[model samples]
Target: MTNNKTSEVPVQDPGADAVSESVIQLIRQHYTLDARRIRRIYAGLGSRNWVVYTPQETYFVKEFISSEDAQKGKRSIEVATHCITSGIASPSTVANRAGEHLTLLEDGGLALFSYVHSDEQIDKFSIDMMAAAGVNLADTHRALSRYTAPGEDETDEWLDMDVAEIVETVDEILGEISKLDQTSEFDEVSRRLLQDRKVQLANYSRLIEPIRILTRGVIHGDYGQKNLIVDDTQCLWVIDFGSADIFLPAYELGRAAFPPENFDHDDWLDRGLSMIKSYALRGALTRQNLVFCARAWLVQLLQSVYGVKQHYLKPHELQEDLDLFWLRRGKATATLFESLEEVEASIERIL
Candidate 1:
């Protein structure tokens, strides 16, 4: 289902002309720069990114998908600023003439930032790179330790899944699966995966309580090789705080070590231990933290299985292609879940 096409210039979307005009006007009015070219970058989820080339310099423009994300975008900028001040390599937000980080757009919000010339090659990440990623994340955590949100009552969209919420979600998914015809392989796999996850949730329900007592902080919600950018100078820069949230450090560490998608490497256990060691040098990681890490990994797999099931249930133009995609993902999740005990044991030994 993935496209393998590579082009120097991105193909224009249907509204490219109108969007280009609006971008130009926004830039001229606010930043006082004339845009020469604007090309869309379709990499991340939920946001429309465009790389704008102006006569002065190149910049990155991010357009939020919803109005609510406008506030989140602003907060991300604030957190990134704090990270940069704490000596972490992060992109700096470019304020407008009015000294505002966010610009109101017709549908949502737009923010401009200095374009970072970095490469995000997740498949090419070596153990050394993983260790470096771990160290970078630790530094980020240390920098963000003192951060206090401007609004005390603000809700984070990237909250960790709790036992009650997970149970409720599984119940809803089971109900939806029961209504399905189950004629296709995708449907069968969905039902099986959901059933397996429900059992896993019940078995691991006790770990969630102790996780609540662990050290908490603001963390990069979507920490992974893809979100990490290795610049031309080989300095690693963390990007995309769209999913930033305040949660137990163990959850972040676990999510970072065990991403939803499987990688090409087979030595994940070693790489994960290296990351944990590097992070432990800067922060704390108790045995309970490792337990929470395993639980977090299971939670992410459950979410992935649910997401793929939902996609399969919904009628899509590329349902035929997506059938294979979801099937492979389901199989991978099942395989990982079956051998999760080994991974957890390894983490425990390291701790």
Candidate 2:
């Protein structure tokens, strides 16, 4: 946890040259790859990612962060492989030079992921898709039951949201704001949120309940649409365990609701419930725990409110930060919150 602001990611360089080259070589060694003809495809805007293209096969290449940041990425790949091996629609790791899913390149860390051929349309997030996601996620959790975090020496729980970390993130964001040279626009509410974070940090303890470890398993810490690759066949190919972890179900559920600002609110809520019900259908979710899952959304929203306030929306993105979270204002914390409340209430009614 460096003091670098929330604006400055711990792993700043996404595509290190050495890592990228190593990844290309590794893929060529292990898979059917056209080393000279490989071209980079733009799959995601955030990460320094490249899609390797060949006549017969296509795969993904990514330069990860430094050693410290690469651990999570490595854990995510391991977790996904476990799920695939256990029959989940998960992509397997192709070749990791460091034996761990990551290898240190001259510029930074690098890893290769199986590129899924996806043509699945972004349908209006429906109950069916949600439920499928949930059931699949439960299966993911079940599969991860045997896996553990890759690095043995690291003691910090990746799933646990530490107060110190929150404070650190806040401080880092503010520092970045100071560096931005344009403070007048963000001066008003952002300042208030920064000052109030001290209170939020204090109140974080009051919000704790007995953590529901519904099942002990590896979690795709960032389990949502952006991370999943759905093929034309409608098969869900889970990828990017960069934010993956070995932790409780509650942690995974909470993280699911905190998507970037541009994501659809209705889709977020509906899919959330679908995931819960799917887990329930698989006997992974119990009635009482479902109520807890609902509460988990609230807790997640609360934390996200803090995070959204701290982190700057993508410069190129259209929606304003507060507008995205307008629902979670005086009465609304996030646009997604009310729908979540309804979902939770629905669960309670059934109970």
Which candidate leads the pack in lDDT?
A: 1
Displacement of the residue 290 alpha carbon in candidate 2, Å: 1.9
Candidate 1 collision pairs: none
Model 2: lowest-lDDT 10 consecutive positions: 1-10
Q: TM-score of the candidate numbered 2? A: 0.66
Give candidate 1 regions above 4 Å deviation: 1-17, 120-124, 150-188, 207-210, 242-244, 303-306, 312-336
Candidate 1 accuracy as TM-score:
0.80
What is model 2's C-alpha RMSD?
7.9
Candidate 2's residue-wise lDDT over 1-351, tens digit each? 011111211112455355445555656655444643334443332345666555666556665535654555655666667667778776665564335555655545556666777664555245666666666777776666556543231113432567686677667666666676667644545555555655645655554453444433456666776666667777776766544444456556544533443244535555565566667777755666666665554455455444354245334232343433432331333343435547668656544
